[model samples]
Target: MDIHFYKISISGIVQGVGFRPFVYNLAYKHNCIGEVYNDADGVLIKLGCKDIEVFLDELQALAPPLAKITKITQETIEPFERSDFVIRQSHDANSSTTILSPDIAMCDACKKELFDPTSKRYKYPFINCTHCGVRYSIIKNLPYDRINTAMGVFMMCDACKKEYEDPTSRMFHAQPIGCNDCGVKTFLHVNTTTIQKDTLYHTAELLKEGKLGAIKAVGGFHLVCDATDENTVQKLRQNKHRPTKPLAILVKDFAMAKKYGVFSEKEKEVLLSKEAPIVLVKKNRSDLASAIAPGIDKVGIMVASNPLHLLLFEYIDTPLVATSANLSGEPIITTKEDIEQKLPFVDFILDYNREIINAIDDSVVQVVDEKLCILRLARGYAPLHLKLPKKIDEKVLALGANQKASVAIAFEDNLILSPYIADLDTIESIEHFQSMIANFKRFYNFDFDVVLHDSHPAYESTKIAQTFDTKKVAITHHKAHLLSVMTEPSECVSFVFDGTGLGEDGELWGGEVFVAKERKYHFKPLVLLGGEKAIKECYRVALSKLFEVYPLDEVMELELDVVKRYKSKIPLLYHLFQSKKNLKTSSVGRLFDMVASIVGVLHEQTYEGEAGLRTEALVGTLTREKRFEFTIQEGVIDIAFDFFASDFVERFYATLCSIVITLAKQEEKKVLFSGGVWQNKTLLEFVISELQKENIPYTFNTIVPINDSGISVGQIMEYING
Candidate 1:
C-alpha cells in the first residue's frame, strides 16, 4: 500500500469562478481521488496515490490562462484515503470579500443550451452554468458559495440539483445555475408592473412601440431602443437628456453590421473576439440617419455578448441603440427597483433579479491593423490587472480623471489598470475604488506607501486619497499625456492631444506637443493670449491679431468689423480676453477648439466635445489643392508660423458670415485634420483637401487611439520618468 500525495494550488480568477469542478473532472479522468477547497489565496487541492506526477503536470498545464497562477506551492505528501473527489466547503478563516472580476457575457456552450429547444433551459435568458456567465453580480461576499450570492433566492429543481451534483456536468456546483422552472426568469415589468410576455419578440414589440422600458443585463440596466427608427431613436435620446453625443449601436451579426459602418479585416477580427467590445467603426457612405452620430462620422457597434442580446436582434431584426440606463454622469442602473423608479421616463422594463454583483458599462474598442486598440476597456477585459515592465521604489496609487474613470496601482514595478466605473462622487464608485486598492494590497501584500493623482486637485479620487497617509506625487496633465507615448517602444516627439486638461498656468489645456522620455518631457501648450480666458473674451486677442496682420485682401480686412457685430452675444468673451495675464499652453486640443470656434462650427457647445466633434466633421467637405505649412521654431517649440500669414479670425468670420448669407449648409476646405477630430469624416476630408498641395504625411488615428482615453498610457510614461 503506497501512500502518495499531490498538492495543488490554483490561481487567476479561479477562486470565485468554477475552477474546482474543472479540477474534479480532470482528477476523475486520471483515475485519481482528490479533495478541492477554496482558500483566501486561491484553490487548494490534495490528490492521493498512483501516478501523481503525470496527473499534476497535466492539470497544471491545462489550467485556464484567465486563472492567473500568481504563486503555486506544491508538495508531495501522503494521500488521504478517499473514494472520490469532492469540492469541500470553503475555509471560513480568511474569507476576505475581495473584489472579484467584472461579470462576462454568456459563452457559446451556455448559449447553445439556452436557445436549443430540446434543452431544459430553452429560451432562458439567464442560462449560465459557471463555464461563462455572470459571477461578480450574484456574489455578495467572497468564497463565492451559492449562499453568498444573489442566487440564494430561487431553490434548485431536481434536474438542476443533479447537474450541480454531477462532476461530469458543466454546471457541477455552479452557484448560478437553473431556469424558469427552477431558477431565475425574466418578465416584462414596467414601473414595477409585471407583464405576461415570455418571448423576446413580444418584448421587442413593446420596445418598438415606444413603451418606456428597462433591461436588466449582465452587469446593469440598459435602456435599449430602436436605432434605425429616427423617431424612436430621437425619443430615447431626448428622454435621456443625451442630445449630441453619439449613442452606441448593438447589431445582430457581422452581416447586418455592414449596413451602418465599414470594417477592415483587422476590425472584424477584433469585433468577433471573445472580449466582445463596442467597436467604433467608420461609416462608408450612406444616409442611415444624421441623428445616429449627429455631427460625427464614427459609430460604436457591438454584437450580442449573451443569449438575450442574440434573441433581441432576431425579434426586431433591426439595429438597436443600447445605452446604459442612468442619468448623465450617474452609475449604470443595476437593479429592478432602479428600473421601477426610472421607468416612467422610459417605456417598459425588461429585467430578472439574477443578482448583479459588479457594475460595468459596455466596453468599446477599435482595430487599426491586426492589433486591437481599446477605447474604453470594460466588461470582457477589466479588473484584470496588467503587470508593470519594471519594479518601482514605492507603491503609487493613481486616481484617474472623473469620467471614464479608472484607478491604477503600481506594485513591485507592475502597473495594474483598474476597470472604468462611473461617477467618482458616488459612494459606490469611491467605495469600489478604495476596496479594490485594498484587494490588490491583500493579494500581493505590497508596499502601498505612496500615492499619485492627476493634477486636477479637485477630483473625488484625490479627495479620497487625503485619508491615506501615503507619500503622494502629482502628475501634470500634459506631461502624463506625453508619458502615454513612452509605454510603447517607439520614440517620437509626442504630439500629445486631447480635449481637456489643466494647463501649467491654471487654464484649460488640450492640444499639445511634447518631446518625451521616461524621466522628463519638454512640452509646449497651444493657448490663447490669456489661455481660455482669451477665448471666453470672444477671442479679442484673435481679432486684434488678425487686424494687425497686413491684409491680403478685403476678405481678410473684415476681421475687426466682425468682432464688433458679435458684441451683444459675446461680451464675456471680450472681457476674458482683455483682463487675463499672459496665456500659454502647448495644447493641441485647444488648438482644434479655437479653430472650431473661429470656424463658427460649434460656438455654443451642447456637450463635452462639441468643438472637436464639429471641426472633425467639417473637414470632410474640402477639396484639398494645398496643405498648410507647420514648422518647429527655436528648438522643439512648435508655432503656427504659417497661420500667421493669414488673418484666420477674419477669414473665419468672413467664411461663416458668407455661409449664412448664402444659406449654405456646408463650408470650404482647410488644414490637414488628424487626431481624434478625424473621427469626424467631414473634417477629415476637409483637411485633406485644403492642404492638398502641401501633401504632408497625413495620418489619422490608425494603430494609435485618437481620443483622450489614450492619455492613460501617456500618464503612465510621464510619471515613470518625470
Candidate 2:
C-alpha cells in the first residue's frame, strides 16, 4: 500500500489541554505512524498514513474535551522512516501564536483520585491532570512546556515521572503534574506560628469558628469565612471595608448552591462548566447571612473550582464567603507576604509554595433573558482570544477605560485580552495594569505599532498612551462602547449608557444613542453638582435633577428623605447648581442613582453600581404598566420626573425600556446595547422582552462583558474598522 506523509498544524487552546496525547492515541487508532509536538504556533503533527482525509476528520471530531482547535491546516510533507508513533519535545520560536488555556476547574477524574483511598493522590490538595488544573496562572512563556511554568521548580517523583512519560497515562505531558511527594506544599500561618500538617483542617476549623482566613487557590487568595454565620460575615465586611457590597460564596456542589440561590438550567450549567465562574442568581433561601448580599435579592455563588476548596469543603459542610483578598479598587493579593501585610485582620493564612505569576480574580457571570452575560472576565475566561477576519500588518495595543481596566493586543489574526484589572484609581491597580501589558507583550513577542485609548484626556489609560513610543489613536468612549458589541461592520443603532465618560463635546456623557457612527439622540443633560463627588454621594445628583423642575423652596418643601437628609448642604449645592460651574452629564447610570436616591433605596454608594443594584433589588417581583412621561424631539429625549410615584423605580425601568423600543422603531435598525448600564439585569431583561414583543431585532454583549471590562476589545475593533 502507498503511504502519504502530511504535516498538520492546529492552533488555539491546544498547548496545555492534552492535545498531544489525544493526537498520539488517535494516530494509533487510525493505523498511522506519526510524531506530535507543540511548537510556537500550536500543535504540529507529522503523520505517515494510508488515508489522510479520514485521519484529519477524526482528529478534529475526536479532539480532547478541553481542547479548542480554532484553525487546522495540512500540507504534503516528505515521509520519514519510523517504526512507531511518538510524542516529541516542544519547539520554541521567536514569535508565539498558540493560545494559552485558562485555568480550569478540577475535573471529575482528578476529584475521584483525590478522594479514593487506594489512589496515590488521595487527599492531595494540588491534584491535577492533563484535563484540568493550573494553566495561564502559572505559565511564564509559550510552547507551554513544564520548564516554562512555576511548577518547574519542583522535580517530579519517580512514579509521577513514569506517569508523565507514559503515552497512555492520563497525565502524559501534563505540565503541572506531580504527586504529593514532589508537589507544592501547603502552609498555615497563625500569629508567629507556622503549621504545615493538616493545614486544610486547621483552616476549615478557623472558618467554622467564625474566624476569617485568607486561603490561596489556583488563581489568587480568597478571604474566607462561614457564610451562614452572620457576625462572621459582618466582621469580614468590616475588615474589608466593603459595607453592603455583596460577597461571593463558595459551596460544595450544585445542590448546596441551590439551597442558597435559585439556579436555572443555564445558570447550573455555567456553574458546573470548566470555567466555573461565579454565577449571580436569585436568592432562594434566607439561611445565608443577611450581610452576605445586603440589600440585593440575588447572590453570587460558585462551586468549588479547585482541589484546595473542594477538600476544605470535605472538612466543613457550611458554605464559605470566598471573596477575593484585596483592598477596595485594587488587584487580588497573590503572595503570602502581601496578604499578611495587607490583610492584617485575618486570623490565619493558608498558602502554598507554588508561585502565582499571573494573579486573577474569579470571573462573574449572570443569565439575562436566558442568555449568558459576563459581568467580570478573569481567571478561566481569559486571556480571551478572538480571531481577526484578516491578518493585519500593524500590531496594535488597546488600553481600555480607566475603570474596570483591561488591555488587549492585536497581532496577525489573533487578539488576546488580558484578565480584568480593577479600577485604575489606585497605585496598585495601575501597576497591575502595567504588568498585564508586559505579560501580553512577552507572550506574543509583540512590539506594538499603535496604541488606542479612550478620548478622556485625564484617564490614566489615556495618559499611559502618551508614554508609548508609537502612534496613538483616541476613540470616543461611547463609540468604543458601541463597537464592542458589533460582530461585523454594518450600520446599526446602539445604546451606550454608563456612569461617566468624556464625550466629543467635552461634557460627561453616559446616555447616548448612535445611528451608525452619528450621535443621533441622547438623554437630556443634567447638572452633576459637586462634579466627581456626586457619583459617590448620589443624593447630590438627585437634588440637582429635582432642581431642574422645582425651585429651591418647592424642592425644600418636598417630603423626599434625600431632601430632608441633606437639608443643610442644599444651600451650597443650590449655589453650585445656580453658578452652573459643575459638570453636566447625560448618564443613565446616574439616572439610576437619582431614582434610587429619590426612592430612598440608597443615598451613598460604598461600591460601584451599589445604588443601581439596590434599586433593582427593591423592585422585587413588582411590575408596573405605567411609564414616566418621556418625549423625543430633535434628537433628544427628555423625561418629566414624578419622584413621588408609588412605584417609581419600577416605572423608571419601564420608561427606559419604552425609550429604547421607541428609538428602535424610529430608526428601523437592529438595536445593540453596550456599556456598564446594561449590566443591570432587570433593565436588560425588560428591554429585551419589549423588543421581542415588538418583533424588533436586538442584541447585547454575551461573550465579552457588557460593562467597561469590554472596552479594550471595542477599542481594538474600532481601530480595525476605522
Candidate 1 structure quality by residue, lDDT tens digits, 100-218: 54566677788778778889888877777766766655666666678878888879999899999987787888788887688776777655577655657767887677554667777
Q: For residues 1-722, what per-residue lDDT tens digits would candidate 2 score against the true structure?
A: 68899999999989999999999889888778979999999999999999888888898898888888889998999879997899999998998888989999999999999999987788889888899999999999998999999999999999999999888899999999887789999999999999999999988888878899999987889999999999988888888889889999999999899999998899999999999999999999999999999888999999998999999988999889999999877899999999978989999999999999899999999999888889999978998898877788999999999999999888888888889899999999999999898998888786889999999999999999999999999998988888887565265788999999999898899999999878889999878898898899889999999988889989889999999999998888888999978888999999988998999878999988998899888774433357898999998899887989998988888889889988989889888999999898888897888888889988889978888888988998889878
In model 1, which runs have C-alpha deviations exceeding 4 angstroms? 1-4, 49-53, 65-71, 92-99, 196-199, 284-289, 340-343, 390-396, 410-415, 423-448, 479-493, 502-575, 618-626, 641-722
Give me the displacement of residue 149 in model 2, in angstroms. 0.5
- Which of the numbered candidates is closest to the native, going by highest lDDT? 2
Model 2, residue 434: displacement in angstroms? Answer: 0.3
RMSD of each: 7.5, 1.3
| TM-score, candidate number 1 | 0.80
Clash count of each predicted structure: 61, 0
Error of 1 at 680 (Å): 8.6
Which residue pairs clash in candidate 2?
Answer: none
Model 2 worst lDDT run, 10 consecutive residues:
618-627
Candidates in order have lDDT scores of 0.60, 0.90
